[model samples]
Target: MGVIKKIFNKSRPSNEKDGIFFDEMKKLLGFKPIALSHYRRAFTHRSSNKTDAQGNPINYERLEFLGDAMLGSVIAAHLFTEAPTGDEGYLTKMRSKIVSREHLNELGRDLDLISWVESNVAPQHFGENIHGNLFEAFIGAIYLDRGFTYCEKFIHKKVIGPYVDIARLEGKVISYKSLLIEWCQKEKKKFHFEVYEDNGVEGQKYFGVRLKIDGNVIAKARATSKKKSEEKASQRAYFALQEKINIK
Candidate 1:
């Protein structure tokens, strides 16, 4: 209570905009922030060209790195406690599923974290990965302002409580491409993903991939990038050969 009051006092907004931000952050975090500056830094983009008094760049990249470490540590500890029977490999894989880029991006989108971004670049120009980046930077801000206890609490409330289902996660496939490759290796079958062609209009180019298995084309797919096209092709191939692959 005393600490909360002190933090609230220290973080009181001096202006209308600051007040709105403070309230919004309080709503998002479920607690008043000790230092609003950390979150401001979290939302700062490199394109904004922001710098601190000492001429150090001020952007969310460093906070994203810190938050990533914090997320891994907290999630790992939870997995360690919850899955005692899981080996190192199993634990690592499960953690990956929970903290997957897709999952983080979903979380960020749900929270509408991107709305707070301070960037010179237009929002339409930002890629899908920016959502996940903002989410990680937000976590980093929580860690900086409130410490590990608050960080753990926020993650638990927002992440673990809702999404960390062991049974569901165990069956979730993080990468169909990896799964297809592993199945092929296990069955002693040669598999390849080849970029067959580039498609789409100017400024929206797409790559076409052919997934070949044992000299025959298993599946083909097109996407904005080679990696995405290959993944899509692998996914199609996996479904085409689902019975034969029999991933378990």
Candidate 2:
């Protein structure tokens, strides 16, 4: 137990560094963190694989889980009240679009959250998902340190007030593949995807996809997964055929 405590203490920043972190937190959250440990844990990446005195793993994953729930609950309530005329399905779908991984990642990037991440691994090695995960963990930390009221305020200021627009979001298509497929069906045009392995960089295997519309290759894309490649291809195809799709 004493050894674990010593290890944790050793990993913590110096007094000067602590001051810098405190100022950074105040700037980011608009409030001082009463318990800096919570914020520390929020920024700690699993690449560090830290552990506590009782052999419990210490990282942001648990905090990320909590923040995800809190974010969903707050967003769901906002959607429910803001769009009273929307049916259950409509509200649910809208919430999904708002809190989508892509959107969260964008939010994190805008906040420059990765600069604060404490990780043993190089930032370049981390996936884009890390940005959203860190954002959720940071939100979880806010809820833990400041309670739900302050957390809600932060969400309103950061998420709802700036980014969310009901009319714009209503017309936004979260899934390019879905939109493309729907358009093709309505236009009586055939569409299909040819997927295959196309490993390239990082010694990591990737999937490549070619999107075909009306038996013509419309676009090609590659990603770490088949679905992602297909989605990328679909997005490209959508832009290429946006005029036609929007017309129809």
Candidate 3:
């Protein structure tokens, strides 16, 4: 069944030159591919305004959903099989940490997924989530194009093997705010965040914050809301404490 799909894909014409996509795909995937359309759609950003005959948008979003599921399933299975002594809560948190958005964005950025996006929207304007979204979408494309076994192979090779560093990531905090709070609490320091209205960007309400620790203004940051602003402020504080923090 998969072989038949491959032949049909080979017969199809592409606006871009042949072998170029295939070769690039090989380098990116670390293996030569039998079909190219799946990758083309994988890389195609929603901004391109493309759709298929069934009126389904020919973007990576749907595939991203599928890939996200696949990733979660695979990661869960790995955790279950390997960590025999780990409890459910431990496994769940570990899985969440592994599949976190920040991690996914890092993977996508490292893979240079942005270069292949076919968006009408300027890549510069994209939000932080774009990288993670595209990464998931790319996974979806691989799953559909090659089926489950190959999808597992790709995820294991690209995601699990290369990126999932267990011990290092275990001590990592996905939220800078939590780390900052813990530091303040442990050091017995009086810390507070002051938020002020941005009064700019009519449609979006922005907030600015200053994180003061031990009567010392450690960082100032801004974001769409008070929470985001505080998180950003906390992140700044964490970076400022680069030399001090245990980072464990």
Show the colliding residue pairs in model 2: none
Error of 1 at 120 (Å): 0.7
Model 2 lDDT tens row, 1-248 = 55754544344345897767877887898766656788899989888989999988889999999999999999999999999999999999999999999989867765778898889999888898887888899899999887888788889977886567676589765777888888888888999999755666665557789999878999887666788778778867876785455723
Runs of candidate 3 exceeding 4 Å displacement: 2-16, 172-248
In model 3, the worst 10-residue window by lDDT is: 7-16
Clashes of 1: 0
**TM match of model 3 to true structure:** 0.64
Pick the winner on lDDT between candidates 1 and 2: 1
In angstroms, the error of model 2 at 164 is 0.8
Note the Cα lDDT for every prediction shown. Answer: 0.86, 0.82, 0.77
lDDT of 3 at 227: 90
TM-score of each: 0.66, 0.64, 0.64
Best by lDDT: 1
Q: Tell me the number of clashing residue pairs for each predicted model.
A: 0, 0, 1
Q: How well does model 2 score by local distance difference test? A: 0.82
